[model samples]
Target: MKAARIHAYGDADQIRVEDAPIPAIGPDDVLIRTVAASVNPVDWKIRRGYLEKMLPYDMPLTLGWDVSGIVEAIGADVTTFKPGDAVYSRPDIRRNGTYAEYVAVRAREVALKPTTISHVEAASLPLVSITAWEALITTAGLQPGQRVLIHAGAGGVGSIAIQLAKAKGAHVTATASQGKTALVRSLGADEVVDYHNPTAFAAARDMDIVFDTIGGDTQDASWAMLKPGGFLVSITAPPSAERALAEGKRVGFVFIDPNAAILRDLAQLVDGGKIRPLIGGEFRLDDAAKAQLASETGRTTGKIVIYTGQP
Candidate 1:
């Protein structure tokens, strides 16, 4: 199988296209013929060895995190899906990834893809959708009619978060550059704040929930926007305890776990036309380097995908 992998992590320049033997599957795994895969920022982070201390990669590493493809074969113990099932997922980051023509994913992490969209579109959803799903629904417990603020509203996670929050009937406010206001609003954001405000939310208060997708200054500013008992949910990094206490609200950090049940439910949302995957761009799978470059720019409004067909 052809795959884009890094022999040693350094920069995007280190990425290369190479021929690798097709991976083998365990009894609990399913081998997918990847048609499309999206590049998450973390893919570049891992590619450059930023995760070396924590999630170190094998010498030759496949860095993609999102996969949308057809099931080519199933492992002995897998029964949830079979050959020809259109599927998509963000496989667990602990193992080899979906940057190849074929990958072996744990059966439990895979979900049937949304019929409403193409494989390329569905390829963009798993990681961001799951992250948003976990942060808003599981950690913060966003409620209907509540005011929630999502930073980076046009981002991969925020775009979907806005929709999911709206789907739950929450009144959503999102922060983004003026260029993306219409995009965010189309996804159902009740209000769009120009992040240029540096103090856009300074005079604002009583937000029931804040989903912080951007860490640094943006995460810090989310404190004042929340109501007294509101929840500040962060998917980017951990929240500061002192800050949470000073603000008098619950602080939660979300680390998305790939669960079949969770992916299945989210897939239903996609199939039901409740949530749509937003694709900012697509590149040939071998152009993983370009994919990584685009993700780091922070200018893209949504997911960037790589189409992988053994060439």
Candidate 2:
């Protein structure tokens, strides 16, 4: 098999496509024939050694996290899936990832791919969807009939977060470029603030939750948009301890985990037409470097997919 792997953490130039051995599965795992994967900012972060201390990976690592494919084989203890089943998963970040032509993922981390979408589309959802789920649903305890603000609404996590919040009956407010106002609104955001305008969200106070995907200034600005006692959840970095203490708010930083139950629920929402995956671009497996570059730029509208083309 050919995999895009890095011998040492550095830049995009470090990623090289080369021959590699097929992975052996444990009794609780399933071996998937790769069809497609998606690029995320964390992929590049890990590649450049930013997460080395936290993730503690061995050298010569494959760096993708999202996958949509067909099950080629299942291990002895795996009964939830079978040979020839279509599945998708945000595989455990500790293992060899989904960048190659094959990935062995724990059966509990895999779910049947939504039947309504293509492999490329299914590949786009896992990581981002899981991030949103952990942030709003698991961490913040967002409820219906409330208000939620999503930063970078056209982004991977934000786009899906807007729709999921709306599906739960929350009034969704999102920030995006002027050009993406319609796009975000179409995705169920009740209001779309112009991200380029510093004061565009000044009137967005009294929210039940704020989901921040953009850090730095954007995150700083989001602090003023929540009412007292509202929750603030971020996937980019940890919330400001000082600000949370002064503002009487609950702040949390979400490190996403793989849960088959969340993926199954998302699949139902997708197949029922209540939500959908947003695919911004596609690249071949050999072009993993290029895809990672695009994600690093922080300008992609949604998920950028990598097609492995393996049967």
Best by lDDT: 2
Per-candidate Cα lDDT values, in order, are 0.87, 0.91
Query: Between which residue pairs do clashes occur in model 1?
Result: none
Candidate 1 colliding pairs, count:
0
Give the true-structure RMSD of model 1: 1.5
lDDT value for model 1:
0.87
- Please provide TM-scores, in order, for all candidate models, with all chains considered together: 0.97, 0.97
Kindly list the per-residue Cα lDDT of model 1 for residues 72-141, writing each as its tens digit.
9999999889898999888989888888899999988998887878889988999888898889988888
Model 2, span 1-311: residue lDDT tens: 88899999998999998888989999999999989999998999999999888899987898899999999999999989999999999999999999899999999999999999998899999999988989999999989899999999999999899989988889999999999999999899999989777677677788889998888877887788888998889988899888899989989999888888999999999999998999898899889999999999988998999998563
Local error of candidate 1 at 212, Å?
A: 0.8
Taking every candidate in turn, the Cα RMSD to the unseen true structure, in Å, is: 1.5, 1.2
